[model samples]
Target: MSDLLRRVATPCIGVCSTGIGDDVCRGCKRFCHEVIHWNSYSQEQKRIIDERLDQFLVQVMQDKLHIINAELLAWQLGVQRVRYPAQKDPYIWLFQLLRAGAGQITEPRKYGFVVDSVWRDSSLMELREAIDREFYLLSQAHYERYIGRYMQKEG
Candidate 1:
């Protein structure tokens, strides 16, 4: 397959909220400009964005949980029909695994994850809430770092 054909797909989850003044898409956490210009970006540009997102997610997951059986976790996510991109980012898989196992992941370690005290001491809903909060915070920081500069030029 050609490079374009083999490129990883956009991470859009269909819940686009960027058009409503949100700096980041709640679904995919991409900056508004990134979403708007995604189709116009070159493969290298797209890869850069993907890598940045992966880095953020990896930071969150590593700080909050430890995966012991990564293979089994991936299999579990697959069995549950969680739709994750084909990229090799473990954090993406971890996100899907948490979403799929929500409420039912009482013993995360069995699935190869060791929940950090930040999450271990909280209920499932609380954990999910914390993750969402942290994710959005990271997204906002990213938007400020990248897009804020352009905004200053326009003012």
Candidate 2:
């Protein structure tokens, strides 16, 4: 479990092509210019983009949660056909990590899925145990990466 919850960095390799109308790259899902000049952007500019990305990510996760909750309701109502909730939406924790900006601007999808899948199957106490373990590990990693970047200034 601890091994499955490790953090990884953003996988962007500078391949960016913003869509024609949306101004966001279909390849990297960021504005093309932001992708092109990511290395050159000031910390302030990067932080702004990161914040917007966080919001977009949260919305994506919220949509998944809604879909999962609706499916759970349907199952409870004795729907004739029900999709596997685990397969349908298994990345909720990843979205939480994105919102929290763990690892200083990265999404460790593999670990996120492992934790989320475990969470979906566990009872309340079991889930809480998993969350506590995963959160403690991940939070420590986040602290190591970002506390010096932001919090130490205040300290």
Report every candidate's CA lDDT. Answer: 0.77, 0.41
Looking at candidate 1, what is the lDDT of residue 153?
92
Which model scores highest in TM-score? 1
TM-score of 2: 0.34
TM-score of each: 0.85, 0.34
lDDT of 1 by residue, 3-31 (tens): 45668579887889998988888888899
Q: Candidate 2 regions off by >4 Å? A: 1-15, 18-22, 66-155
**What's the distance in Å from true for residue 23, model 1?**
1.9
For model 2, how does the per-residue alpha-carbon lDDT over 26-101 read when each residue is reduced to its tens digit? 4334554566687876666765655554444444444332233433333432332323222222333343333333
Deviation in angstroms for 24 in model 1? 1.9
- Model 1 C-alpha RMSD vs. true structure (Å) is 2.3
Clashes of each: 2, 0
TM-score of 1: 0.85
